[model samples]
Target: MDAPTVSRDFDVVVIGGGHAGAEAALAAARVGARTACVVIDPAAIGRMSCNPAIGGIAKGQLVREVDALGGAMGQVTDVAGIQFRMLNTRKGPAVRSPRAQCDRVVYNREMARRVVEAPGVEVVAGEAIELLVEPGASGGSRVRGVRLGDGSEVLAPAVVLTTGTFLGGRLFAGEWEEAGGRMGEAGAARLSRSLLALGLELGRHKTGTPPRLCRHSIDFDRLEVQLGDDPPQPFSFRTGRLDIEQLPCWITRTNAETHRIIARHADRSPMYRGRITGVGPRYCPSVEDKVMRFADRDAHLIFLEPEGRDLDDIYPNGISTSLPPEVQEEFVRTVPGLEGARILRHGYAVEYDFLKTHQIRADLQVAGVDGLYAAGQINGTSGYEEAAAQGLMAGANAARAAQGHGPFVLDRASSYIGVMIDDLCRVNPDEPYRMFTSRAEFRLLLRSDNADRRLTPIAEELGLVSAEDGERTGRKERRIRAAVERLRSVRQGERTLEELLRRPEVEIDDPAIAAALEELGLAADEASEVEAEVKYAGYVARQAAQVDRMRRLEARSIPAGFDAASIRGLSNEARDRIARRKPLTVGEASRLPGVTPADVQVLLAALSGGR
Candidate 1:
């Protein structure tokens, strides 16, 4: 055999090219790192591994935050999105979110194009089989590079693992099983072993996708049509306008017959048969699980969403399963408006390994290892938006670490991304972690419309924001400030426009407010944002005060490399957990599972020169 090929060095190396890896590579390169994205198939970058959509509820807020941070997900969706809707329009401003159904093929193409054309990024078609590390003087290992399948070794100071579900992946369809990350993709078995050897704890999680039906076979006349918003709202602050034609999705329901068919085949499911030992997500349960758990319910909604404009496949949402092919066919016929449904692909569940998030820092760096980071599904988060957010943070911080910069950490009071990172580091989620409005205590300050305000400045500080992006951000800020000042100066019925907006019955589009907005030349979306700020001013102030009080606890710092085992007045369990996690602050130690408020007080007193 010929000698193994050794590739040139890069500053940062990113493995796996899904949403997480794609964003990671892009962010690293944009931040001036010589980055390489190693993937099984270069063309599969940012492939929609599950549904053909992005953003929903709290997830939408994350996508906006990613865009604000000079990341590519938001801009890409603007180009590939086929349908857009603003969720929670009837709810409070803090809860409203924008979701988009994208054309899968176009999304992948655009994402790959970005990775390929990025200035300092190189896309390499190779599978990484091993992680190379060297022992540091401090008795810890630091990442040196990764070994690829083609007998080529790529060297880098920092390595980001956005491996997604490919790490020891196994797919199941009823009684049938195969080793695959996605439908036709191979699993990363060797890398999983390498990770185990490196001493990182791994746990298994299972996620499923619904079957794809032929669009031509479905009778859409009997289904309810769901149209896009009248004036579609783009996810990115930089997207000037969406000029493409919109598509409408259809809604159908599974009837009693559908339930009966699913129930009869429940025993054949890998999940129910005990063939799959991995824990599945509780929030997005499969059809069989839902049917058995909610036997009293008569029907469940099934959305018939088009996969792409050119593709004939339809994604049926809310019925993900891993049942036999025959059972899937029989159940499709039982659903309303799907009597003649043709299966383009069978729904299957994939079980894969994920590292426990407690081993990760708020900056996305893996604990006890220098120059190594983990993000995306490997961190146990369930949504594409969540993965991309983590990837952006991880990639940027990894590049910074390689350059000897301080670790970049977001505070919980600032953005939803901060809350997510804090949650991952503080608690080990029993189920797959998916973001929701209820999880964010400071939702009022983390509204979807203002992610740019909260994060772009930070991105600029980190050298991720470009000149063009900074200019756009500046323009938007000016308009918002101008509009708010105009509103504050004008009076409507004895109250200023800003004060009038605080009334529950008033809207930004009210005659007086609209005329003022027109004079100020503010866009409709911009006006809505100003309206939210004015209406929620008091609540925002109150939340900010609470944040100030909490920051005192955060300010009480613990010494570096502080040993929890050395502290007194702590429970055994609390000591064990704190020692393993190595929390940096007294506040972080206070949030450990078994740690009590009294324990926190004792730790604070001890750190402040008390016994």
Candidate 2:
């Protein structure tokens, strides 16, 4: 006899328990939705499958934004961070970002704890093999829930799919290939068919990880040591201070011999041999790619990072590859300090299925499928921070959809989250999308130091944050405003203190400014915000005006039944693209690929009855 099918009900169901799913579940619960998170292995929740670190250039800004919105990633990072550093210290504040090397095991356990202990959230140990859908009253399919591998079903009004590199996943190391997502975890083999059945377009993307070496085997003395900042900064605004002892990472480089070995075995690589068909990230290419692409370069930097304070494994930050195990062994030995290193786990690449970003709306909901949403790597984005941000938005939106509310959407002028989602929705990436500071046009307004100032209000309005947290952010804002006004009034020679601070060379600690800051009694973080505002007042004003103009354009609505083909002077390609996209606003139509400024003008004319 067949096993009996068991059924359970939830307001929202989240599939996959990686960074994205954990945040999704937590966000759903925060929104008062009874959420169920399905995971193949309950112990692997929030697993850092690739790098054992969180936050980088543009990525740190994302983590801060997530935290500002009351997301758990920043808090968990603070609890588990072994080493914290602020990158790009000499650069402008817009590019400065915080990064933390985490205790991977602790990060997972802590995140899992938050998800499990959160009210209204249930952690289910099982693999989701199918999505339950029914015909909608509006003549389209809507997600009803998900079906598990063990003949059980979770019925919900909304579903969030945050399957990080697990759908149709295949791992490759040299000549060896396996059907798994990570080193030892089996892939979600049947979920791809379910997604395709709903008419969602899926594409392939590849990401790889470096080998883990036994810490004791590494000749640490031979490598140059890279230490955390003297006063390490935390990723979370809630973290008062970093109290734990920080660990040091070491750096080495792959020499000419290493490149030569990789080149000799290039044909053996799955990617080069045509076994892996997915497009990999351009910025974080594998070792073979680096060697082959940059043939003139003789060396590539590698950082040896500890997986945890007490663990025996150390991750080599570069040299990710899928060359056979023997070839991996050969090239790794050629690195200066790794000559005596023993590989605890060989480096490998995993190619997985992801939905094309264009198929999802800005709210992360599948375009035509009501109540179905996707986030993280499944949306063609790579990085834990990106995944976490998407998860938070997707979960919150799914909960709102269940409650019969409108979607919460962020815009490019507001936060990095808005920029990422906007970029994803407007264009389909040919390769995996990774966040970078350069990606934001208004990055100067989206600095990491002021994430709370930018997003906490939105979080509070959405009930994602506590009233106490909202009050705290308000106090910080008040202090910053008071400080800026005080600076404007205080005089230094003929100019005000604010004017002096704008000179770039004059810091807040300058004798004249320090006295004013002392009188204000602002905290370090608050003072920094004041400094940035005063220093870049002119640029900030310019950007704010630009934002206003963009918002005005966004406010101009496009009629649902408007005919794009009726517009004169529009290119044939632009008209066809606009008609098919059916953009809801003038601003969105302008952003679509191949839709030129001339096309937007014609669209505006048509909306104004000029055509």
Tens-digit lDDT track for model 2 on 1-611? 24538999999999988989999999999989999999999899999998779999999999999999999999999999999999997888889899999999999999999998999999999999888899975456888998898879999999999999999999998888999988899998799998898888899999999888999888998989999987888888888888889999999999999999999999999999999999999999999999999999989999999999899999999889999988888899989888988998999999999999877877798877778999999999999999999999999999998988777888899899999998998999889999989999898899999999999999998889999889999988988899998988989789999899999799888988989878779887777778788888889999999999898878777875778887789999888877766666788778988888888888888888887
Across 55-137, the per-residue lDDT of candidate 1 in tens digits comes to 99999999999999999999999999999999999998899999999999999999999999999999989999998899954
**What TM-score against the true fold does each predicted structure earn?**
0.96, 0.96
Give the Å shift of residue 346 in candidate 2: 0.5
Task: Please give me the total number of clashing residue pairs in predicted model 1.
Answer: 0
Off by over 4 Å in 2: 1-4, 557-584, 598-611
Query: Model-by-model lDDT, in order?
Result: 0.89, 0.90
Tell me the alpha-carbon RMSD of every candidate: 1.9, 2.0
